[model samples]
Target chain A: MQFKYDLEGGNFSRAGHASSEVKKILKQLNVDARIIKRIVVALYEGEVNVVAHAHKGVVMVDIDEKRIYIRIEDEGPGIPDINLAMQEGFSTASASVREMGFGAGMGLPNIKKNTDQLNIESEVGKGTVLEMTTMISS
Target chain B: MKISEIVDVLNARVVCGSDKLNTEVRYAFASDLMSDVLTLDTENLMLVTGLANLQVIRTAEMADIFCVVFVRDKKATPEMKKIAEENNIVILESPYSMFRAVSVLHDCGLQPVY
Candidate 1:
């Protein structure tokens, strides 16, 4: 099955809606709780990153019997340094985003931690695309 | 600890999901940073935070947390309550500060997860 959602940038309130919907779908599909949790965490962190940093974006979730795939594409001013941005304690979110209880710099690290495979492609002046996959244990 | 006991200990009001007061919680975690909460392995714990937003409920759901206690009398919006109710997550509002709320729960035998 495939699911997609539009992510509005700078809207902290709606950040995790996509992830939440995906979690609900995973639950209904009887996916293992552990795998569901992993997917939720990774997708949620990515969703927050898109909202906090991007201009606007879309989240696409593809689920199969063997694995779940997530792709977040944003048309924002992309990251300048993927390595530095992947560090656990690095973030560029504004004070307002911080006040909403995000931007702790753990977004990318958490995303990386929960997924079996991860890839990030971006251009400094154009946009970013984050792809992550978590395998389902038989 | 039962959610009812947590409410009594922290003097917290049920903001939503009152039917879940009988739910049991094994550990507790207190943090305002949603990212830290996500990274922490807090299964079946009650989250205590002063932050009031829809994302708080989302964090609790992602972590499989059963309950959330908003410390310092933080008010949750109707939308937050709606989301918590949908997730079957018990929501409580405590007038006590985060420190005092944690201390009260600790005194009542609710241990924190390090």
Candidate 2:
């Protein structure tokens, strides 16, 4: 099964809408509880990243018997250094975003931690694409 | 600890999802940062946060956290409560600070999610 959702930039109110919907789909499919949790964590983090940093973004989710694949593409100021961006204490979020209890620099790391496979590609001044995959079965 | 018990201990106000007050939670974590809350791996943990935004409830929902206690007397908006109601997650507002909320809940037999 596949699903697609659009995310708006700086729209904190709608940040988790996609993740929550994906979670329900996973539950209805009877994916393992542990696997669903991991996917939810990673998907939510990725969803929030787009909301916090992009002009707009798209989330594409594909699930099958073996693995669940997610791809998030955003039109934003791409990360200058993917290595630094992956670091735990690095973030470029504005103060207003921080005041809402986010932009603590843990978003990317949390996504990487929960997903078994993560690929991040970005070009400065252009955009970013994140692809994450996790096995549906333990 | 039951959600009802946490309410009593913290003198909190149940904003919504009163039907879930009898749910039992084994651990509690307090953080104003939603990112920090996402990294938690424990099961049946309740969140204590001062953030009253929509993301707090959304994060709790994604993490399978059944209850959230807003510390420092912060109250959630009606829209956030609506989301919690749909997700079946209980929302509680406490007058205590985050530190005091954690201390009180810990003393009341709620383990940390570390």
Candidate 3:
């Protein structure tokens, strides 16, 4: 099964909509709790990243018997240094965003920690696209 | 420990999931940072946070946390309560500050996730 959802930048109010929906779908499929937790953690972090940094974003999820895949594409000021952004404490978020309990700079690291496979592509003036996959069966 | 015991000890109000008071949680972690909360990889956990937002509920859901204790008299909004109900996660509003509440719970034998 596959699903898609749109996300608005700076819309902290609705940041986790897509992740929550995907969680329900995973539950309905009786996916293993450990696998589902990893996916939800990664996907929710991705969703928050879009809301915090992008102009807007889209999440695409594909699940089958063996794997669950997620593609997140966002239009924003793309990261100039993916390596720097991947650092655990590196952050560009403002104080206001931090007060809301986000922007702690652990987003990307957490995503990488939870996903089985991850690929990131970006252009400084354009946007970023992240592809993450997790094996669900076997 | 049973969530009901927390209510009694912390003088917390059950914002939702009153029926789930009987639900038991083994670990308690307190943090306002949702990212820190996300990294938790355990079962039957309770999160004590000062953040009262949709994201808090979402974090708990994603992390598979069983109960949330909102410190410093924070209460969940209607939307947050609605989603918490759907997910069967308990929400408790405590009158105590984060430190006092966490200390009390720890003294009451609630184990730490660390």
Please give, for residues A66-114, the per-residue lDDT of candidate 1 as tens digits: 9898999999989999999999899998898888788999999999999
In lDDT terms, how accurate is model 2? Answer: 0.91
Give residue A128's error in model 3 in angstroms: 0.6
Best of the candidates, DockQ: 2
lDDT tens digits, residue span B1-114, model 3? 899999999999998899989887789999999889988787889999999988999899899997999999988999999999989889999999999999999999999988
List candidate 2 segments past 4 Å from native: none
How far residue B50's Cα lies from its native spot in candidate 3, in Å, is 1.1
- Give the CAPRI class of candidate 1: high
Model 1: runs farther than 4 Å from truth? Answer: none
Ranking by lDDT: 3, 2, 1
Better of 1 and 3 by lDDT: 3
Count clashing residue pairs in model 1.
0
Please state the interface RMSD for every predicted structure, separated by commas. Answer: 0.9, 0.7, 0.8
Q: What lDDT does each candidate get?
A: 0.89, 0.91, 0.92
Top model by TM-score, which number?
3
Model 3 misplaced stretches (Cα beyond 4 Å): none
The DockQ score of candidate 2 comes to 0.90
